[model samples]
Target: MIQTHRKKAGFQHAGLLLMLLPGVVFVFIFSYIPLYGILLAFKNYNYSMGIWGSPWAGLEHFRTFLTNPDFFRLMRNTLLLNIYSLLFYFPMPIVLAILLYEVRGRFFKRFVQTVSYVPHFLSTVAIVTLMGVLLSPESGIVNLILKSTGAEPIYFMAKPEWFRTLYIGSTIWQNAGFSAIIYLAALSSIDTEQYDAAYIDGASRLQRIRYISLPGIGPTIIIMLLLRLGDLLELGFEKAFLMQNPLTYDTSDVVSTYVYRVGLMGGEFSYATAVGIFNMVLSLILIGIFNQISRKASSVSLW
Candidate 1:
């Protein structure tokens, strides 16, 4: 009987491995295979010569990028943009989730959730285009309202100072509902007995939330934060690129967008590759640091 049970367990494990095989192969092909391209960072790539045939460029690409006049500007812009998002945009979803959990009416709750989530499904091009139409200086509703109120028309997208606000605000609007889903999932796992017991004990809503709900989700919050902090420098490339124009370039040019121009547009493949490697390394370091901090502070992390 024991032998039969062990054989059955072995078969179950084998089935699980079979289920996982496709995902492992997918990562190996799509993710691990791409590591070979990192070599382009150190080589002077040529179309005729191909990657393998390209001559070594040593650290010349890195040197040039470091010495460029725009180096500081690009670095500063990228760092600040992400930092600002971390500060302003990160907490929004948590707040949204908390509010949603407290929402009483089913219809209103569903309505709010649906409205918030719809933007997440919209394509970036569509969102940006809609933004353009809404913010158009000539005949947009915003300008019309301003004109009616006897205020001067403001070109939001054209102003460098407003770029960060626009970008971060749009991010909050677009992803807050989707981001809230994780927190909501965490909320569902909390024991309802705790809430019922707290209520019977005459605990106020705020006190219950503080003592029960927050503590229950504390580990989850820490894990999510660590995951986010790991990619501190990886701002959304497509949205940033779409939002960028001559006026907003000062604020909007990030590492990814600059890499696109260098590698694809400017044809400095080696230099672009170097920049990408730098970004990946920086992201790795930040993730490590945040993970360590999470482990130390809360004994919870994403290892």
Candidate 2:
């Protein structure tokens, strides 16, 4: 009887494994398989030699990346960009969602949300082009206004000082409303009874929001923050690369753009791969640190 029970348990475990087959296969193919390519970071890669045949270079690639003159500038730019993004992009969505949640008129709230989210659907190329046209030094709307006021036209895209502002501002404008949808969903899940109690206790609108709504969605916020921390090093290459030029390189050149230049343009595959691995390890460290902090302080963690 015991042998029969064990056989039945084994069959059940096999059934469960079959149910997970697709997901397991997907991760194995896409994630684990690609990890093998990380070996290129330590090798002198050549087109003729291929990945496996490339000669090992020990820590040469890493040494070159770390000692390069541009290393500090690239690291500083990337770090500051992400820090600014975290300061601005991280909180705006939550604030927007809270404001929307407080609105009494459902139609007006939806209309505002719909209009705001429209920017997120626009192609990045189209958005950048529009920005250039609007901020052009000569005939652009912003410059035209400046000219009317007898102030000089600011060459925003070309100026190093403006790059971080433009990039982070554009991201906020494009993503805030769309990103708020998840927060809004979290807000919707809050218990209506809690709000009713607060109201009965003579709590003001702001008070109820402060004590009830904010705390209610705190876990969602913590989770999103953890995820963002995990992606701290991964700024979008398309937008930054398109907007950057030699003049703005001081502020705009980041890890992704550097990797693209070395790997695709300069044909320095090993150096680029090494830099990429460095970024990944840095990101992993930041994620682990923040996850630990979140678990300790807020009792919310992805793991």
Candidate 3:
């Protein structure tokens, strides 16, 4: 009987492993296989000779990127944009999730959730195009309304000062509802008995939220903030590139966009790769510092 049980358990474990096989294969193919490209960062890559055969450049590329005049500008833009995102975009989902939790009607809640998250599925190109159409100086409905109100038409996408506002606001709109999914899941797991106890003690709705609800989701908030910190320097290329024009480069230009222009377009592969490594290192350092503070303060951390 013992021998039979061991054999049955082994088969069950094997079946579970089989279910994970596809995901493991996918990660290996898409993620790990591409890691070989990191070697190009240290070499003056030549297409004719290939990556391995390319002449070694050592820290020459790194030095060049560090010494470049545009380096600080690109870094500043990237950091500031991410900072703005944290300040403005981060709180939005938490607030949305709390609001969603308070909704009393099932159908209205479901409808609102669906509508809010649907924009997340739209392509970035589509979102940028929609912004262009909706904010056009002369023809856009927004500008038309402004003009009718005796105000001057504003070219939102063309102005450097408005770039951060548009970018961050659009990001919040596109992502807040989708991001609330995790918080909602976390909130749902809060014990009902805690709320019951708070209510029986004659606590107000806000008091219950302060004492029970916020504490329940506190760890989730910290983890999400840490994750954001991990990607501090990785402002995505596509949306910024799509929204960017020659006029807005002062504010909109970020490391990823600069990398595309200088590395891919200009064929400075080693230098661009060096810049990427620097950004990665910087992000790592930031996340490490923040994680340490969080761990000390709250006893929760990614590590």
Candidate 4:
């Protein structure tokens, strides 16, 4: 009997490996192979002198990036943007998922989920373009509404102060529904028995949710938060670049945009690579620190 059980376990393990094969291959091809390009960070790369053939300059590239006039501005903008997002945008999906979980009518819940997730499917370019049109000072709906209220129309896209607010608000709208999907799945996995017990104890609906549902998905929430911290410096350039002009540069210019401007557009490959590597390393360290804290505080982590 033991021998038969062992054989069954061996077959299961083989089946699991088969299922994992494609994902492993993808990671190897896309993630691992590209790590070799980190060498460019230490070199003065040129077209003729490939990554390996390029002359090593030690920390010169890093020094140049750090000492550049806009270094502090770039760092501040990146951190502030992410910090604002964390404060306002991060908790939105969790709250939304919780609200969604409490929705009893199956048809209504599904309809709401469908509508919410639709924005996530829209391309970044389309979303930004739509925002631009809606907020345009001349012909936009927002300006029209302002005029109706007897207020002067503001050009939202042109102002430096409005950039972060617009960016974070758009992010919350676009991704919150999609982000809630995972938490909703997590909510479904919770044992119904605990909820029933809470109900029996004269617990109110909100109390039951507080004690049972929230704790059930607490680990998943913590894990996502840790992952967010890891990418704090690596905000997407597409929306910001598209929305921004010289007028909004003070607030909108971030590390990713700076990299694009200096590296790809300016043809400073080595400097760009170095800046990118630095941002990546900082993210790794922040992720590690946050993960450790989560493990200690809540016994939930990404390790």
- Which segments of model 4 are wrong by more than 4 Å? 1-22
Model 2: per-residue lDDT, tens digit, 38-121?
999989998899999989998899999899999999989988998899998899999999999999998999899998899999
Candidate 1's displacement at residue 286, Å, is 1.1
lDDT by residue for model 1 (1-303), tens: 999999999997998899999999999999999999999988999989999999999888888888988888888898898888889888888888888887899999999999988999999999888888888888889998999999999888798998898898888989999999988888889999999999999999889888988888888888878878887778788999998898888888988999999789999888999998887898999999989888898889888
Q: Sort by TM-score, best first.
A: 3, 1, 2, 4
How many backbone clashes does every candidate have? 0, 0, 0, 0
| Model 1 clashing residue pairs (backbone) | none
Candidate 3, lDDT over the whole model: 0.93
TM-score of each candidate structure, all chains considered together:
0.94, 0.92, 0.95, 0.92
Candidate 2 stretches with Cα past 4 Å from truth are 1-26
Which digits, one per residue and each the tens of the lDDT, describe model 3 over residues 170-275? Answer: 9999999999999999999999898888889999888987888889999999999999988989998999999999899999999999989989999988788988
- The list of candidate 1 runs beyond 4 A from truth reads 1-15
Model 4 lDDT tens row, 40-77? 88888878878888899899999999999999999999
Global lDDT of model 4: 0.92
Candidate 2: worst-modelled 10 consecutive residues by lDDT: 228-237
1 or 3, which is superior by lDDT?
3
lDDT ranking, high to low: 2, 3, 4, 1
